[model samples]
Target chain A: GAGVSQSPSNKVTEKGKDVELRCDPISGHTALYWYRQSLGQGLEFLIYFQGNSAPDKSGLPSDRFSAERTGGSVSTLTIQRTQQEDSAVYLCASSLDSLPADTQYFGPGTRLTVL
Target chain B: AQSVSQHNHHVILSEAASLELGCNYSYGGTVNLFWYVQYPGQHLQLLLKYFSGDPLVKGIKGFEAEFIKSKFSFNLRKPSVQWSDTAEYFCAVKQALSQGNLIFGKGTKLSVKP
Candidate 1:
């Protein structure tokens, strides 16, 4: 139970609708990350949050995809106006630090389906 | 930007057979490498990692990986595999200077028959 946990193991939404996925990181973790895994494709980095510093949103596909981490513990990934292409398994990970060497613990992920 | 390549999309082997999975990456700067495995109905778990020091890294489940910096390769190997080794393997990389955001490769699914 110490590992990362994601809510709504699966999500079904209509195209152009909005959906929110939540992640609860490991206790005492200071860094969190979000990634998207599409069928037959690699895991794509979406965003990262390190403590109180500004989050890195370079990997976000569009302005419709947004995420926020409150109090550095729980995070939410909100997809506005979701498209069919946006459907994929959304994974959340957390680590003690943002260092490249740190081991990241991953969640089971939420499978998002856009109809 | 960094990218990872996993040449093997699927592999099938009998129990006790030697196993090898090829992985390569491209990055201009120093990078941290990792191999993760996801068993059926399970989350991804760390298999091995290479940061510095010895290029050969040993991981759990009797698996190991050799980091060949010259070739930009970190290939996973096992002397002999078991049925329990069946899983999807992913290779990932993170730039040493940047924040921790992994660039993962398309996973290779391995099926070991007992």
Candidate 2:
């Protein structure tokens, strides 16, 4: 499809382990975003990458959550020492730009479970 | 602080019933509004958006939303809903001062009976 694509539709891991989630954004999209959707909670912005520049990591819940967008295209979200509380659907979205009017396209998302 | 509120957490209605979902924002400035729908196991899709020009905008699936600046409200409505409309709907706002990113509400789950 021409939409965003995420790897590992579902992920399960033991507590305190680490996991990596990948996202391939729409071709030529310069803006990439990472968000987490917890049960009963809205989507929480984690980080954003704009054309390979330094990303905005303001929304990361903790230092353990890190993400990187290589060549301003595919991105990866790595969670270190994952805890049970970190279990949620990690969603990746891409947009042409983060401007006030640009609409983002979201991927199906990767449901991560920390056992 | 800028926040979006969705008063209706969950709504249930039979097919063909009219639908309305209330959404309000706290920002007192020009803002862009949007409604996104997520099916059972699908990604979030844009149902409609209001950037400028029209206060009442029409979207796919016979859905429409009116933007009211006075009350800082943007509610989603549909003349008739179907079982396929059973999904989670999210309301979000992009305030002029929001740095161009969206702040989404908790979302409302709609269940339509056929």
Candidate 3:
């Protein structure tokens, strides 16, 4: 079975530019999550989506960051007016469900560099 | 708010040596614990997880973690390590019965000398 996949393995852009990162979860996973991994922040959760319920955006650092999952499968994280501090490897994960017992599988991640 | 702490930032050991990586979370409620590993060029993968029944959970590659509720800790250990086992280990936690995100610690990088 295919694991999660993220597109544009590496992206470099100037500060204040907008970037969109895409993620395709496993075939039937209903729970999807986004995280950022940086030298300073380590790994931090950004957002989560479960079924048709409201997405959890509590972990999103600021309003400039937002994500959307369409058709309950693919997700895209967009950063508006990116800053140097936003440069990091963006990771996507998914599980069968939102249960605590279920394990989340991660993707290769897209490395975003704010120049 | 829940947070995870990994005691060591990095550890160096020789092959066949015993290994232990400490992890502690600050949450009084019931929680699920997980250990994830990432090889030098690979994506992160689940090593093991502890939900309820057994406190001692075994994972892939001869890795295991013990969940101590009273201590709020889940320490990963292995009796013998191989050079191939060198990687970054992350400890994560999520509140039980909630559809919350996993809170991860600043990972511990293990360097195994062959």
Candidate 4:
């Protein structure tokens, strides 16, 4: 079985630019999550999607951070007007369902650097 | 707010030495505990998890964690650690039966000398 996977293993962009990071969850997974890992903030949850609908977006640091999932399979996180503080590793995870006990499978992550 | 705390920022030990990493959470209700490991250049992987049942939960690669509700703690332990066991360990907690996200602690890096 293929685990969750993210695209653009590494991205370097200029400040104020927009960057899109993609994630592909495993087949049959109904719960998808996006998180950010940085030196200053550690690991922080950004959003969660259950079957293409986001029910939790509380972790988004600012309005510029947004994510969407389609068909319950693929998700894209877009950061508008990226800032230097946005330089971090973006991680994606998926689970069978939204149950608290269900284990989340993580992806390799996309390392984004805003210059 | 719910939060998790890892007592140690880093741990260094010789091969065959015992290993213990302490973790505590701030939530007061029922919770799900998890220990995740990330080896060099690898994605985060589950080391162990405790949802319910026995307090002692064993996971892959000879790893185990003890969930103590009274102390609000879930500590990871390994009797004998190998050089290959060097990695970063993370403790996470989720409020049981809630749709909330998991709260993670600052990871503890372990360095092992063979």
TM-score list, all predictions: 0.97, 0.96, 0.98, 0.98
Give the DockQ of candidate 4. 0.72
Tell me the TM-score for chain B of model 3.
Answer: 0.98
lDDT of 4 at A112: 98
What lDDT score is found at residue A41 in candidate 4? 50
Q: What lDDT does model 2 reach?
A: 0.91
lDDT of 4 by residue, B1-114 (tens): 999999999899999999999999999999999999999999999999999999999999999999999999999999999999999999999999787478999899999999
Of candidate 1 chain B, the 10-residue stretch with the lowest lDDT total is: B94-103
Candidate 4 has an interface RMSD (Å) of: 1.3
lDDT of 1: 0.93
Ranking by DockQ: 1, 3, 4, 2
Provide the fnat value for model 2, as a fraction from 0 to 1: 0.61
After aligning candidate 3 to the native by TM-score, how far in Å is the CA of B59 from where it should be? 0.9
lDDT of 4 by residue, A69-111 (tens): 8887899999999999999999999999989999998999999
**In model 4, which residue pairs have backbone atoms overlapping below 3 Å?**
none
What TM-score quantifies how close candidate 2 is to the native fold? 0.96
Candidate 1 backbone collisions, by pair: none
Any idea what lDDT model 4 has? Answer: 0.94
| lDDT of each residue in A10-113, candidate 1, tens digit only | 99999999999999999999999999999999899999999745468899999999898899799999999999999999999999998879999999999999
For candidate 3, lDDT tens digit of each residue in A1-115? Answer: 8999999899999999999999999999999999999984558998999974545888899999989999999999999999999999999999999998889999999999999
In the order shown, what is each candidate's alpha-carbon RMSD?
Answer: 1.0, 1.2, 0.9, 0.8
Q: Tell me the TM-score of candidate 3's A chain.
A: 0.96
Q: After superposing candidate 1, which stretches have Cα over 4 Å from the reference? A: none
TM-score leader: 4
Local distance difference test, per candidate?
0.93, 0.91, 0.93, 0.94
